[model samples]
Target: MKRIRFVLITLSMLLLAGCGLQNTPEFQPTLQDQISLYCLDHEGNLEMREESGRLQGYCVFTDGSECAEADFFNGVCKAGEIFGEASKRGEIGVLSADEAVEVEVNSGSVDADSGSDEIVLE
Candidate 1:
């Protein structure tokens, strides 16, 4: 019947549209955006500097007696100890290696404070 054919065509169109949506790429936020949101949520702040083509930085949570610091290079912290505070805070959970790379990339954006030769996270 004509009605049956129309209904089948409509359902087919709907199914094709749904399949197209599933294949569409979703937007992914940059690592810096995530860090900024986390800092805002946790009352934390970050300071960083680039020296001799290396990035050094730290993050502190004002409301908690916890902090993290590292000298990042080649997608990993030089000393492998940057996430101590992150682990203690426990909200962000464990960071993967890729996230660590993101952190290093984010640090590349900071300008060194004037006349400050060294930044101590402690």
Candidate 2:
């Protein structure tokens, strides 16, 4: 009984440790992450949820881990929007720049803003 309990405890610890395992800094950019970017080239509304200057992209990982539906356009991140997390596969953005900056989303919502507001990360 003691051995079984010990094994179970060990397994639980390992699982929790694995879940918490993540790269340090969590602030640097990685290349392997999958990302999608969208830009507002023209001023037309197809009910595409047309917003201006918003970077739309996401970073996907091999293990099916990913940061999806992130937005970035210019040089500023909208409020309640985080770029990504270290624990995540990788951070991706829509309407993102050719290069992604190293940033971790500390808090906030990643939902698309109104048509009036543009999504840009500086």
**Best-matching candidate per lDDT:** 1
lDDT by residue (1-122, candidate 1, tens digit) is: 99999999999999999888756577898766565455445455666667569764455545333233322322233222335544534534545433554432323232376664333332
Tens digit per residue, CA lDDT, model 2, 4-117? 999999999999999997867755434322112322221111122223475435433333322333322332333233444421233344322344466575555433655433
Off by over 4 Å in 2: 23-122
lDDT of each: 0.49, 0.40
TM-score of each: 0.27, 0.21
lDDT for predicted candidate 2 compared with the true structure: 0.40
Q: Report the error of model 2 at residue 97, Å.
A: 32
Residue 37 displacement in candidate 2 (angstroms): 19
Worst 10 residues of 1 by lDDT: 71-80
